[model samples]
Target: MHRDTASQRLHGDLIGQPGSRDRLNTPALILDADAFARNVARMADFARRHGLILRPHAKSHKSADIARAQLASGAVGLCCAKLGEAEALAAEGIDGLHLTSPVVTPPGIARLAALARRIAALSIVADHPDVVDALAVAAQGGPPLTVFVDIDPGIHRTGVASPQEAVALARRIADHPSLRYGGVQFYCGAQQHIQDFAERRAAIVERTDYLSTCLAALTAADLAPAIVTGGGTGSHVIDAELGVLTELQVGSYIFMDREYSDCDLGDGGAKPFETALLVDAGVISANAPGLVTIDAGLKAFATDTGPPAILAGAGESARYRFMGDEHGAVIGPDLPGIGARITLGTPHCDPTVNLYDAYHVIRGDVLTAIWPVTARGRSA
Candidate 1:
């Protein structure tokens, strides 16, 4: 048997500690074990109290080891963005797979159908009848394939445009011999990190109304969407209040990014979660005045959301700005000298993590252990 005991051994020692290597490398992904667990526990406890199922988005970390940690902390399942990611997770032997994106081709559908047999639960989203038909044909009964009707909740993205369209698609799924109607998947990706709480709330409110209308329409047509899954880390609370979502598929709660940390979380002005993920880089050049350079840049971190931030009290008075691949410039007061180490909060957690092979878990400065980013580059 392939032993998973290795993960437990490695994860056991990689928490927060100081006094190890101050400047060993550059452009490395770092995980603060204590902060990560705290983030997990916080979300788990919230889900428990709210009576909402927590199916964390695995796309954020894309690590089977982290996915296992999330499941252990009370996640009902995992949400991956593509089939490759699902297959990777399967290789690690973690069950409960839900592909957030639709699988619509010959090879992809067939592969997903085969995967359903191995996982405890497998779900896919459909925006049209053609997609549903494709899945039904491939999944000719190894295990029942659950299909969620993707509804456009005002974002005009991957979901079906109208409630009537969603209902019609739902009927098709129910009639399909190989598919089980898994309800609705409504996620407004554009609103996930809107900085302004009111704007975010308004967007969700509008989207929720449309989602509820679609659910009601489905019910009127004698179609019951058993699961109404949606929401990200930014809108979990809003999803909870909507009373329509049976589960919250929020990711990034486990590792709050710089972009999310800046968003206003409705009540007063607090972030939905704490920042837990960071990139550790070293100063490669401190030869200029009021200017310094580090090893992390466009290739090391994601710039889609924004620039990364220096971790608090890391002897970093300088601010990090992306220069190009493999390099970043720093501008601030009393920046660390050459060979000094720095920790950075990624602008976007999901994509930033995709760039790394493994996370170097450390407690202050001690190199505790490492976990592979098993699902990285699984963008299919």
Candidate 2:
């Protein structure tokens, strides 16, 4: 399982201890087991009721345990962003992995071919013809690998630029004997974090309309994609209502982060997701009058989203600042004293999660389990 030493030691010694939560070493990743369960169930039920296949992205949690939980709750499979993440999970016996990003390099393609042999339903994306041609050669090296033509919805990041280009690629994929043209992948990553619900929905509709054109073109050419995938947590509802994606690539709803929490979820004020994932940082120094230093800093949390949010103790005006790689200061009135444990909300769940080696799973005050982040550094 590639479990970290601290997590392994703690799991054996501190599990079932009355104050296990308090005894956790500083700057530890925490997951409220009950809340996490509820989050998983809610997303699964939503997908079931809506008639959408749920293939939640494993890139967010990166834990085989979490991925299994999602599968138990009716998720069809797990979607990964990197080949390394898929290989790591496959080693743990996880199946139905679909790589969202393209593997264009010679070595990456060879690895992709190898992974396809290891995993029965391994699928990948192709944004360019050279990538497709290379994948065709690799597919012959292993079993027939499922390839999804990545359709770019004006992001200019990846995928075929136009509907004509998409259709051409789909045709090219069909010509290859060891390749299966599964479908198209249109992920609007840029629109997922739009603060306002209406604005986010508008952005999704625009992209969804663009995807429809690609789908229509492919269908007209008798190359209709059997599985249309790609819709993130932020745009899940909007994308579902649009009736395009057959399956969802929703991630981050399991561990509601500050970025997704700030977005208007159409409930007026309440978020659709609960804050299940958290960082438990201990107060190190309280000598500063209005601010107290915490054990978690840049190294503990992701710096891309500014700073972590104090879930309690610090008032509404509380502002977290990065002091150093190993330390952070929470500036606000009536801060917690030294040794007091502070729960923090991550700004960006995916990257913030990558910083930790294990998750200290808590069911109330007891340490239930210590799930290792098996794919922590498997960013290949």
Candidate 3:
């Protein structure tokens, strides 16, 4: 049972003691350190074997320590959902940050510009001329800001609608002195979670076809992207096969959620990554027959992807259902009584992680360390 003095100082008395996994406050985020390390190594190896740069999305874990581990394990850099996340990671000396989402507001642009000057290398995505112009104006007199033209892969969420628009934005970024055209970002966010492997592959093929058109347009204008970065955990293998993406911007692979677990690998196999993240909860009430309530529910995990799965404890027949904002019902034969502990797997790792303040790092049954979710609530 060893405790780091820095962790104690930062977390104060709230940090749990070593070998105190059972005593840890319930409904806390639990990270299986071994599985996490293996996942990092597996993805790194996958990227290396495929000759693709691995820039794991930090928005998944949001822990600077986890980002460090990914980088130490051969990740080229990190991708963040917002400027605040990039700033938080940069504060920890984590360089090579890419803001995946566009920053159009004045304050966000200013922050992005300031961060570009401070970090080793900072890049951001833009899909509109106004955003490109704003970034160019904000980056004036600072280090050259790398800009990725975001192309819509039919999601129509934030990217440019057409390849023509993507080309136009790329030309604008290239024309701007303060901006450097990094490449194109074509992420089909909706297609990332397609359950069937064949369907996922087919979807990516269609997306990549659109991407090829965008790439062709860029090339025809003498604005070939140096990098074509966009792919998630579900589509990394498909993306590699396409041979278009230079870097994989995957996030959830480090912490495979139940939703991701349900996604078919196209080969009729399980997901490539391990389930490294879990929620440790305690049975608070077992008053009912064959049913018990845990201390985790909608407030503890994200509900967008459905209820969290009961990974361990409460017997083999255990089933979990959200009862309310702070309670979950465990129904099954031989249910664990009050005071029993159970490990619940998240439905969606990204939003589920955002609900926690820190991660309780566990090695086997011992609580080894606690790392703050530094970028938690940094969705700007």
Candidate 4:
């Protein structure tokens, strides 16, 4: 893995180089600045129109610059996937940070307590009393840390299974010495892109109903949830209209990927966000007929959602297949010859982004800026 030194070291600057789009940069990540700005604005407007607080997830971009732009465009704050991510963003003075995942270790909890002293409001999620107890001990006399109960809502991920479990966890958080019960998180990650509108809606309805029940239980126990957070780019509209999610935590809306493009929001149109992020690679070899190879392969993108879509140059039916560690194979009728450049639309933006060191921000064919993936290796 290439350590991201673009933020510190000055290698060949890819952003301002001549023939940037045409030059073959091996396994480089690209971002369309215009498209990214548009996506951010659209999501911000959507939040404003529906009276919902937008706390975009930083786990997608992992760049302080992108987080700053979201904040400037009226985002309430940022949501990170881990305590390390929160620490990285807090180092950049990002206030109102929320750690979406449960963090239970002593060192992790200690870091969270230290961060709570500087930021406006720092929060995290938990699904059990053990984690809450650990966090309470860590924040014994430090600043009060706002803790949220994570509800599974059929995802069966890192959250409590039912309303009863959520209520029990909330009570534990409330009773803990250093933890304050902030609210509940009901993010159904699996149902984010179900492809079918009715299926997606049904999934969200079930999750929302579960969240409502949890909230009711919390209230009955005199522990009214102050913040109800969950939802992604695909379910933002539904979550907003349902009027249950106090704050929407959509991340990938700022850079729509091939996966989200396949999701029909029942609007008879493509996703309302722009395709901002792309992987720029060079055609390294033309070994066979109807086949061309590029320098971006499994190392350039995550294979969990399959290979990326081959955009730019030649045909609409160009297929991107993983070749090996650092190469991608494309097959199409009009696939260009050797040394040709291409922009691949990532299958999954978040994990694919984590594979890159820096993003080459571009305006049309002109390279403009470079932003480091600040929290790139922050997986703790």
Candidate 5:
């Protein structure tokens, strides 16, 4: 086992001491410690009140420290997008890790089996018979592998197409002695950001109805799943109300991004979770009037959703435009002079987080801690 003292020393060196946030380098990812704590508590309380299992997706933050905080806040487990991510968290002693995506390749299955032996409980998703067979063969002499049937809820990404397909896959998993059928993973990745509350609810209702059909088929075949896990930060409330989702895999709630902020929460109010994640960029040049250039550009934050929003400093009202790979332009009146710092909120948290090496954790303008992005490049 990894030593606790060694881990503390390494984190201590990475974080150093709590002091002014200005002392840190520019264009770094910063986490508001207070806001982060509040977000964790809020999500945990919501899950507890609704009687839903909270399995926050680690793909959003990818920091073991953040995962520990979520687990401490009453999360049942952590969900990862890839085997490398699961391996990184497992190395830090995070048990109950579940891979949200399916693994069908022989080499990936072999690595996952190896990780299963080390962790207390590891689960993965499957939408095809080939993946089921490969996983069963991989777990021949190892411990029983838990598997969830991936149900494509209108996303058509990677899951079984129909209820009949889901039942057949569940039966095949049960037939394998090395595999234990966990449940169904019905996630609508595209529906999460629907701007209208009624639209979001309609999308989830349609998906949940399909899920109920799969559940009934599974029960008829005497393969009733013990867990029905699928729901994101956007539709957790709706999923809980439908009475089908046993656990919620909401990840981005910990760090609200501009895309989530733009989404309606079924109510004309702000998101319950605070915007805890920010990118600190410094004014590199103020050569032009009413315009200042920052060091962060397309490379600093994810541009697929949109440009990053200025959260603090003189650039709050400024319009952010991508200047180049290494630079961004903030155009507005009374822009900050050269060397001044500004906080930028990412358009999307997950991919934006992948760009950073560590989080400069802060509490009231003082850098309190630094958590390494342990799973930053764990896409393999």
Candidate 6:
């Protein structure tokens, strides 16, 4: 009964309403269509200018609509952090998905094998010999599986630690009739969020040296990887400058969160991207002096980076705070009126997007599209 309140069925219902956002239920995820398209075009253009492959990470938006737009913009494919995420996108007619993480669980490998049999093309990474062996067995009955050596850039998250190990893994993968040695995936996640572009570049340069050592070893052994993939929104500008990765698995740039908004991408403190994603919440109670309660709280946003930063419909002094699972508080000299809408920039975009079921795409004041978060809750 309250699904309408959540805007679950408002695709064409908000076409011509004046001040349309004011009528939305609190805690709605909205995308500024114009800003979003600009971000997409800018990234695509950058990739083209540099002659690099672009496989934008689908784990960021999780919406097939966004994925389709990216493919049309000339992205080679999309990268999924999880196999289930790839499946969700594939069910919506998406192909050319590369799984970036290694799958080790017995049940997971079985599912990966089954998924490989049906999809047009699927690739995965392996950090250990056991994982490569399992994949080789799983691919025997399906189409040949492309396997990449997940190279560790001094971070043990998932990748082969040494160049020798990478070469060994590549040889093993190549020897298998059902396994094709694809390339390497080296990603230093912490480096991407360093805030200061110069510091981030210094860190990435160090990691690139380590990756270079691995690549040299692979090349000397005649096991050189053809497609090297890794990088994220925070480090895209730097990654392009370095020229190591043949392909970029950038995630996050499409929706500038509070974190990315603060990132100095060497553009003189201005990010190359704009904040296109926002959460619309409404004031529920203004009884407290200088403070008001809002409908969006912990459940409405991702808390890993901190509280959302107030965007629109709020005064200069506005500061947001999480009050509970279903409530938040805004304190400022000037607060929004009761039942008035407020926009927010999430601290982290990827996880915050996972919390929503759909994106309410808007152009000016009109709702243009209601795109489902195709891979939401598909993190397995």
TM-score, per-candidate, Cα-based: 0.92, 0.97, 0.95, 0.94, 0.95, 0.96
Q: Write the per-residue lDDT of candidate 3 for residues 1-380, one digit (tens) a residue.
A: 22243434544454346557777778878899999999999999999999999999999988899999999999989999988899888888889998889899998888888888898889999988988999988999988899999888886788998878887888899999988999988887889988888999998898899789889998998989899998999899899899999999999988899988898754686557789999999999999998999999889999887888888987888899999989999999978878999999999999999888888888877777788788889888
lDDT of each: 0.81, 0.89, 0.87, 0.84, 0.88, 0.88
Off by over 4 Å in 4: 1-19
Give the per-residue lDDT digits (tens) of candidate 2, residues 1-380. 55455767756588888888888987889999988998999899989989999999999999899999998899878999999999889988899999999999999999889888877788999988888888998878568888999988787888899999999999999899989888889889999999888889988898888898888999999999988999999998887799999999999999999998888865365677899989998999999789999899889988887788889656677778899989999998878888998888998999999998899899888998889897999999
Please write out the lDDT profile of model 1 over residues 1-380, one tens digit for every residue: 12343333444344334554353345678788778888899889988988888888889998888989999999988998999999999889888888888888888987898899887888989897988888888888577789999888776768899989998999999998888998888888888888777788888898788788898899999997778888988887777776778888888888888777888765565554667788878888988888779888899998886788888424456687889998998888777888777778888888998887777766666767677888888898
lDDT of 6 by residue, 38-79 (tens): 999999999999888999999899888899999999998899
Best by lDDT: 2
Clashing pairs in 2: none
Q: What C-alpha RMSD separates each model from the true structure?
A: 3.1, 1.4, 2.8, 2.4, 2.7, 2.3
Name model 3 segments beyond 4 Å from true. 1-19
Worst 10 residues of 6 by lDDT: 1-10
| Model 2 residue 369 distance off true place after TM-score fit, in angstroms | 0.3
Residue 356 lDDT in model 1? 78
Top-TM-score candidate index: 2
What ranges in model 2 sit over 4 Å off? 2-4, 267-269, 313-317
Mind giving the per-residue lDDT tens digits that candidate 4 earns over 135-160?
Answer: 88887877778999988877577899
- Candidate 4 global lDDT: 0.84
Global local distance difference test of model 5:
0.88
lDDT of 2 at 98: 92
